[model samples]
Target: MARKEFQHYEAVSAAVPGDGAYSAAIAVKGLGAGGAPTFHRVLQDQTFKTALAADQAAVQELERLIDVTSEGELMFAQD
Candidate 1:
């Protein structure tokens, strides 16, 4: 897993085990907040062969995130 600090939030890469593969996802949470962190699944239409690959891909996608809204929304960089 990869973690990065973003203002008052901390974003981390996650690999969700599926039937035969892993799903790329990012988990974001407020640095000092109380509630559970929110999860944002990325590259939804794709699956990785390994958890490591999924985590790496999630990290890349996390890097592409421009911001995490106050309401826990993910803002992506436009192409």
Candidate 2:
């Protein structure tokens, strides 16, 4: 979906973190064809640490679910 939206815009840019951190922003030009570009910056040291940890936990949970699903294993929905 993001790719499709980017196609609508004439210009766009992106960047990825190198050292355990990442930040990027996008700029679009035009109306519904592009609209306004969004800017986002993240410094993953202090404030970003909490968010990063939460995301890692979520990924771990997903991996466990995938393992169960592959093995035809069943567990409580709450788990």
Candidate 3:
């Protein structure tokens, strides 16, 4: 059995609504039928109180989806 190849994408957070909150976006990349790379949005407008907080939350979510620890360090999941 061959392991499927996967791409890693960084979660981005941007300011929105002119408030302290931020909107998060994650890109999904895949190989098209023509064997060309394609990119699309998997998530958008995920609100968070602050940009840094949003980015940290995004990283944790990504780690959960990818089943990998953040830099081999332990992170507790929030309730």
Task: Please give the CA lDDT of all the candidate structures.
Answer: 0.89, 0.32, 0.37
* Index of the highest-TM-score prediction: 1
Root-mean-square deviation (CA) per prediction: 1.4, 13.8, 10.5
Clashes of each: 0, 0, 0
| Candidate 3 per-residue C-alpha lDDT over 1-79 given as tens digits, one digit per residue, 9 for 90 to 100 | 0112234322222233336566543323332323422222223546677756655554544444442133322222444
Residue-level lDDT tens digits of model 2 in 1-79: 0221222232233333345643332223432643444433222232223444434433333332311222223221344
Comparison by TM-score, 2 against 3, better one: 3
Displacement of residue 79 (Cα, Å) in model 2 is: 10
TM per candidate comes to: 0.87, 0.23, 0.37
Number of the top-ranking candidate, with lDDT as the measure: 1
Q: Model 3 — which ten-residue stretch has the worst lDDT?
A: 1-10
Ranking by lDDT: 1, 3, 2
Instruction: Report the candidate with higher lDDT, 2 versus 3.
Output: 3
Model 3 ranges with Cα > 4 A deviation: 1-20, 31-46, 67-79
Prediction 1 global C-alpha lDDT: 0.89
The regions of model 2 sitting more than 4 angstroms off are 1-49, 67-79
Error of 3 at 51 (Å): 1.3
